[model samples]
Target: MAQATLESAAAPRESAPAPAEAKPRRSGKAATGLLTTVLALLLALFIIGPLVWLGVRAFADTWTYPHLWPDSWTTHWWQVVFGDKALGVAVQNSLFFAPLTVLVSAVICLPAAYAFARFEFPGRRFFLIGLFAANAFPKMGLFVSLAALFYALNLMNSILGILIVHVLGTIVFMTWIPSAAFAAVPRSLEEAARDAGASKLRVFFSVTLPMALPGILVAAIMSFLASFDEAQGTYLVGAPDYMTMPTQMYSLVLNYPTQVAAVFSILLAIPSVALLLAAHKHIIGGQLAEGFQIK
Candidate 1:
């Protein structure tokens, strides 16, 4: 009888109903999830709306004051802009200058970045502060001086002039980015390679470079975009003959009052987006994502 009673008690406890506490908790979670989804939708609309509007306006045949939508939509603006020989030339020039700037900037800045990140250089802080300070100054501030220098050197209106200026302007930023990237690499990895009889150069090439590649790639992409999209200096230095897309856009705006300018703007953004996507893999590569630990 005692055994039977004990067995019955255990069975009832084991088969008991679930506590009511879990019911409210599940309901709270579902409500929170619904609120989060609504917030995300709102944020997406806020960001994507402007981009969609620009695309719509670019395609509009006749946009007017106080108009929410164009009276008619057409591809005439795109056809005209793309069909122009000058537009083709501008695209060519931008393509050449942008990649050249990225390459030159990377080459020139690599040594400086490595030194800053790895060595005990004198006045490093001062150099870094100066770099940030230089960025704060408007590009326009140097236009007059740069133009005068170019004229004196007989480099005005030359592609070389544009390329050199873009390289110099982008170097400061490229160096800083890679310096931070190189610094994020643990010194222990380099030491281990050395202990295994790897030379400094070898270790750098095999270990250090690969480890810091993502940041380097990001910096390169940024430099490319900056050079590609730069308007002010390119216009000042590359006027008349060396018309970049930006200079062409200016010419169009001055001569025409249509949405052709928006077409150019959209086309200009293509290279930037393409470059970003190309570098996206590197930006999220396993080595960078796991090893670098950069915030």
Candidate 2:
């Protein structure tokens, strides 16, 4: 009789349905996920919205202040930007200064990098500190001195003159950048090359250079951008008759309106962006990680 009574009680418990609490826990998790998704979408839109608006404005015909969207659309801005004589000259000047500066910086800085990385020299830390210190100074402070120097040298309005200034200004930073890169390379690899009867110069050219090429390329890209984007130095030293894109954009804004200024800004940004893209592969390579290994 007791066993029968226990069986009757257990039978009712086994067949009972699951509790309501489990359903709400699942719903809460789903709600949190949905909220996160919504936030991410909003953030993406906020960041990308301005670029899209700029593109739309660039392609539009009307650039009046009041309208958010264009009343009409045209390619006149593109045609004017592409076909102007002054603009063409500005582009050519930019093309000349940027690469020349990059080349000059490499020529001047590569030896410094190699020495700092491969050799133990007295006051090395002091030299690197001083180099970085130069980079940290406000570029504006050097303008008057540079302008005076250029005037004294008869280089005030010349393209090559402007290039010399760019290279000088860029050297400190480029040397530091490549020094870090070269320092990352294994000393053993270089020593091994030497043990195998390779001359130091040959080892540097064939082995060290190939290994450090990526960082060197990145530094060159940076040098090119710095030369390309320099405004105050170029303006103060070589003004009026010579117009870089920044100087031109400034003139347009003061004389015309925001729309024209925006067009020029967009055009000015293209070459820098193109250079970064070209150097992207090297800058993102694994050379850095490998170099840092103590072995």
The most accurate candidate by TM-score is 1
Query: How many steric clashes between backbone atoms does each model show?
Result: 0, 0
lDDT, candidate 1, 53-117, per-residue tens: 87787899887878889999898888888798988999999888888899888888888888888
Cα lDDT tens digits, model 2, 130-174, are 776766777888777677777788888887777777897778657
lDDT of each: 0.79, 0.74
**TM-scores for every predicted model:** 0.79, 0.78
Q: What is the alpha-carbon RMSD of candidate 1 to the true structure?
A: 9.9
Clashes of 1: 0
